[model samples]
Target: MEEAAIGDAALFHSEQRLQQAARVNDTATIRELIWGKVNINARNSMNRTALHWAAMAGHERAASLLLDHHALVDAEDKFGMTPVLLAASHGNLSTLQTLAKAGATLTARNRLGQTLLHCAAVQGHPSVIRYVVEDLEGIPVDDPDQNGKTPLLLAAESGHSDVLSLLCELGCDLQAVDKESNSALHLATRRGHAELLSFLTSAICSDAQNQDGLAPLHLASQAGHLSCVRTLLDSQCQINALSSRRQSALHVAVERRQPPIVELLLRANINLHLQDQQGHTALDRAVRSQHAALADMIIKAERFHARSLGANGQTGELDLTLRHVGDLSRVRSVLWALATRHQKPGDWKKLALHWDFSAKHIQALENQWTGSDSYKEHGYRMLLIWLHGISSLGKHPIKELYEGLVEIGSTDLAEKVRRQANAEQEPARRCVLM
Candidate 1:
């Protein structure tokens, strides 16, 4: 047993030396080993023969020497990688030709089911890619890896533009879906590969849905790839495109804290009221997630959009903020007076409900309290809510509220607000952000 163990160790050391020689292109050392009758098909622990190492190292002469001694041209290591596959991955064109001529299996795959084309694409080896896909009479360029990723998909996913371009020229199925049902375009957009994604623009319908039921636009937005998002949007992708869960790109953006993307979507007239599976609108999501600024921005955009649609019977380009800043200040002041004078329970609630403070928005504001005089706080919140709506309509919110007060017999507060607006200087600075 000891002698056998010793013998095995010696052979292992000898094989390591041969592999080392092949790795460094030491042909003379390889010749010496072969001359000593060393097994030409000797495999290392990974079952990678010296031929595999020589092919990977681009040692065409060493590979030829091993082939001359009857090395198994199709021998695969533990990774199921044939010598030809390694040669193709290294862009060893001459070695690949030699292996092909020797009847090496061009159709062989690794344990992951990745073929030479897949390997070449991943390595960005255009020459090897050409040789495998063009030279081989029946090459399987569209064969998928274990991940169901084709060579073209791998090239796109790897961002190998040259390899990807060649595959595109070769007419590989651009719309072929992977195991995850992710088309090359989906993978490209998900990876933020704008150039590669652009290359796949020839698909009849770019709205191919993946397993998650998200189109490329949704994935691009969710991934926060601004360029990809713009590209998809320009492709005539539905701005309010929803996922399987009914969450639009706006919802995904807010959930992921992508404020700039949210702004872009908002300007595109995305449906802010479009709720997701949680029954939460984008603004609701923003507030729930503590994105107060984002929530306010959405509120501003929604009101402005509604007013822009002329739903309120308003028209023309009135500057909502410039016209309403003084109005807002006076309304806040009047609310304090009304709360103090009326001293009525549920007045703030009536005002908030009357001015259209969303139940959710008013609830969020009410969560922050200081004593029993919370009506004053709710009324103030209501005034701010009214201000946001007024700004959106591009009208004077304070003036509208002032008129309502006069009709309700709050003539004293109404006159005070009118006097204040007349005393201001256009108030441009106060409403610049609005």
Candidate 2:
């Protein structure tokens, strides 16, 4: 009990000295405390030693003073984060350099499997990264953390072009992939950094493919990065390259509803009809995505090759010699062909069941039905009208619909539908509705 009491008293004094040193930047007082037999590596409630506080506050002098008194360089806080990681995260280059030179192991990983280099790269301190890369020998240039992201991959993903360039110069593997089999170029393209994408495209030409067989161009096209798409196209990348899923760049562009990218790919003579592993063509994907512009472009391209209507007038064949028409009739013919082949019964039912609406096909459908009146005179017209009314019912608001459903004894069904709709709409929130 007497020994325990003495140990407690010493710990109390150590805590006080650490707090005092942090407040006044008092290197002398800190040294005196260490000399007075206070534990040099004593951690407070947060498991932070005097060195951590000093480094966090950019107190290089105090940090140096502590180190001179033999403060533990590798002392970790509650998070297992060392002084070097904290210094790098706080952008204190001098303090980081001090810790490094003092034999703080550069290979130390925190609880998150992040090394000091990952922290420096993520914090965008190119100088710190360069110092770590150059000064710290044996630091793995391609070592990925828990996320399989190397420092170079993190730098590229975060749009740090200068850091990326430095990493490349230091022989960081340009082709290293993360958990998703995504290379640095994939991250660059996914983030829409055209300049970085270009640099990476030129840096690692062969290792750009991910597990999905998606190259940087396919990723850029999928993400609708028009400039990146153009850059990839102009890079002489194999325009006909297919993903592991057998999806071509054109297919992804159509699926993403990026008409500009579609146009650019078409100009490059990319096979517009190239299908994925599921045997669905680019036009099929465009129609599924409900992108009228892309569908029209594909149809026009097909007509330019003399392939008219396919079986059942649903699929169209190319007919190059056919004269292009700008009238409503011509537009109606195209919509009829696309909707018949692509829009299923379930799609029509969804249009009728949900109040969610898109005006994309309204004008073309009205023109087509008015010309022949077959859709109107036939039972299909009544079905279409009923669907339109149902689609417009819940437009007033979900709260209003909820009350209405309760009155009609359909509250349970309404709730179920609302939950399903919310789930479906989550990913689309970031998408441009048009």
Candidate 3:
């Protein structure tokens, strides 16, 4: 028993010595150890043999010495990482080539199911990646790891531009997705890989969405990646693509308070009137998030766009129109009459809902009450709410205001308001305030 215990200690010590020799590329000491008939495959506590140590240290001479001694080239460490995998990870081309030429399995994966290409990609080693991809035929080009992330996907996540360019040049699957169906474009955008995003021009980049229905632009906008957003926008991606929540990139930018991206989306003439899953617009979202600058920017952009389209509203001054609509004098007379007759402050909220003012927009408008009476303020807010709907519809606000008055039993005022648009189009005609 004592002799066996001594022998086990000697073996462990010899393995330790072998690791030390390999780390320094001491080929003479390694050859001496091999001549002593030392177990070449002996592993330390981490299950890593001398060749694993040599591969990790990038010692080509020591690695060659071990290989000449018939070292277990494909032996896995505790993590299932073979020497070739380690070599690729460290950018050791010579040692890696030696292992590959020695029949070291290129497809051998660690516990993570990552191949040499996956490691090379993640580490941003283009040379190693090129050899594994170009030199070695039949390499699993799109084989996924445990997370279903392919080599291209991993490269995109880390913003490895050159590696990605090489992969793209080699005709790799540009549309490769991860476990969540997030495409390479999705990851590149999310990580702000502007150059990489610019590299991908396939239709998948413009259309692929993750599990949440968020496209690459949505991720880029949410992450506040200005250049990435520019690349996506330049790629001619669907600027108004909505997510599962029916929210656009504009919504994401506003929610995240990204002003530059918001400006980009706004300049693209995105549908500001589009409602989200939560009944919010980009303007409303900006207000809800308390991003005062973003809110002002959204309002300013919408007003400018509305004017550029020659979409003048009846509200006169464009600023009075709150996000695509405003309260016309006709609706004002109706609400003004109701508040004057009934003198109820809260009652106007119900009428505001009747006009189809979004509860969110209405709630935003209701935040402030002015004048001596809340009823007057409520009436004013109700007028503004109706104007917003009227403005977005680009209809005759004056005509619509007149119709609302007649519907609410205020025909006397309706007849008077009808002449407001006599010089313009018909009552049913969609016209902005002119």
TM-score top scorer:
1
Error of 1 at 355 (Å): 7.7
What would the TM-score be for candidate 1 when compared with the true structure?
A: 0.73
Model 2 worst lDDT window (10 residues): 319-328
Candidate 1: deviation at residue 396, Å?
A: 12
- Cα RMSD of all models vs. native, in order, equals 6.3, 15.0, 10.7
lDDT of 1 at 433: 20
lDDT of 1 by residue, 261-310 (tens): 77777767678889889888888788788775577667666656656676
Give one digit per residue, the lDDT tens place, for model 2 in 1-434.
99999989877977777766954679878877877887778778888888888777778889888898898899998888999888887778999888888989778888878887888787677888878777777778788999899999888888888888888888888778899888888888888888886677676773358877888888888888989888887777888889888999989888878888887777666786687998988877766665655655664454333221323443333322213322324223323432353333334334323432223333222322334433432223223333223222223233343444455555554464345434444465522311
The models' CA-based lDDT, in order, is 0.76, 0.68, 0.77
Count: clashes, candidate 1 = 0
Ranked by TM-score, the better of candidates 2 and 3 is: 3
Model 2, TM vs. native: 0.60
lDDT of 3 by residue, 152-214 (tens): 999989988888888878778876789899988888888888887666755365667899899
- Cα error, residue 75 of model 3, in Å, equals 1.8
Residue pairs of candidate 3 with colliding backbone atoms: 312-433, 313-433, 314-433, 325-387, 325-388, 326-387, 326-388, 394-431, 395-431
